[model samples]
Target: MTKKGKKGPSVTAKAEDRHWHGKRVKARAAKNASRTGSKTLGPRKPGSSRAGAAQGRAAERSSGATRRPDAPELVHGRNPVLEALREGVPGTTLYYMADSDERVREAIKIAADRGIPLLECGKPELDRLTDRAVHQGLALQVKPYRYAHPDDLLQGTAPLIVALDGVTDARNLGAIVRSASAFGASGILLPERRSAGVNAGAWKTSAGTLANMPVARCTNLTRQLKAYQDAGCFVAGLDAHGGSSIANIPAADGPFVLVVGSEGKGLSRLVTDHCDLLAHIPMFGHAESLNAGVAAGIALYELARQRHT
Candidate 1:
């Protein structure tokens, strides 16, 4: 008989070996899939790359969901929107919910005449855009105001600059801009923070003067005042208890920067220290203080008179 060195493995054993190998392969694949799923569902720690990516996505969504800070401002209400359009406030678009009202029709006409894009949106959309303010079926998207450098106002001989210290009222700022333009002021200076910016309210209150006036924003008011001083401009702070009257200031005849304070508080301590002189508006009436807008108007008139004389 032929010699057989060893008995070959049984067919049953061979089949069992294949079955075990297949089960092992399937188990490994399922384990890998579970691990990947866990990673997808896992909570990320703060400051981790994954967390940062999630935060970035959230920020993007938020920016898209609401109006951006630098976006064009919306002037709501039929009269306000119409007036803004009439005053030629730079506008990109005119949005209206209804055109039945006369004011709305007029505004639509004005916008069309000015070649501003007209967008007909629903009431809910208008409310969302205007922050639920009284839109009255009309809204005008005004262009953002462009600011000038603080040094840019140094042009012209004996340039007069009005610097606001802590004025936070937009309407007050608008009024001041009106007065500054009227008195031939070179420009208006404002602190970047804790101050009112050129907004719709300011545009309305300015009565078109904002278009002509140049407003400069500075990061540090005190340092900007020093820079102006170094440039041969006298820095004067308007104070109720100032040592000298605004009319008698010799600096008014030369390059000057008149700093106006807030209505509630006069000049800040740092600004007061940096001032070359503190000048007050003479008040014979019993009124102890004036609002920033009125005070600025009076002070500017005095300074203008001094310069002209």
Candidate 2:
């Protein structure tokens, strides 16, 4: 039968009929063996159709089926590995290249302290483990990151929220999280679509600051920004032109949410329109633009400085 996307094996009543018939034949064979008092194993009495279906489902679950899509987690680099161990990121194993540097040696000590198994391997093995990322001589296997709900960040007191708009690079996301954590932001918000989600690369890039920072995902970033504005929080978007200077924004001292855009594409029109103010970092150099992480760090530092002073 033709499927929605492409044609493949038939998946219908005929296929199911064949499966049940095979089960019935096996049941008869088991009954014959029991009647003859044979040493061979025999099947238990079959149940109703409904019971059989439920049992099948239970068996599948008991077998630890991978029904959900879960991404693998691998944290690499000396700083990330050390930080992950310090933050208790639930590492399963640690890998260090042979003839490692002092940093990797220190990592091994920490891993041993935590009772995590360590493997000394060559560069090729480390490369395969980290998927060719810059491992810097150390790697750690970690569990998938758990993200927070948007409402979790909005409760209780007003928060300093940093929202991302279409930032697809995982490394950029991690760097932003590190900066946000350092600057006292309550949490980082990411849209459910068209944005990078937290992953091993991001976790590594954050230098394990991701363990402390709560990342919340939103269905619609613009809609959420509007809700924040309604709740007396100033909503601001960062852009390259025609906006208030980040250093002088009065809202920086108050409850505020900063929306940062992708490096290639600035904020989407819908997101930009929802902002109460569009702000930009003052630039005098010949460079036209800054990296997404750098931009976020600068804006966060300004807001933090304003709040402190």
Model 2 CA lDDT for position 107: 84
Residue-wise C-alpha lDDT for candidate 1, range 191-296, written one tens digit per residue: 9998878887677677667877888888889988877766667677777656566777754677778899875557888988787767677766556567788888
For model 2 the local lDDT of residue 138 reads: 84
Candidate 2 lDDT at 195 equals 78
**Each model's Cα RMSD:** 30.7, 25.7
Q: Per-residue lDDT of 1-309 in model 2, one digit per residue for the tens?
A: 101232222222231243233432333233213122121111223447687567545533332112234524677778878887887767778888865477788888888998999988889987766657677878887766677766556543447889999877787898899999899998899998877777776776787788888898877888877666555566777766523567767546555788898765677888877766666676666565776898899889999998889
Worst lDDT window (10 residues) for model 2?
34-43
Best by lDDT: 1
Model 1 residue 155 lDDT?
74
Model 2 shows how many backbone clashes?
A: 0
Best by TM-score: 2
Model 2, residue 81: distance off in Å is 1.7
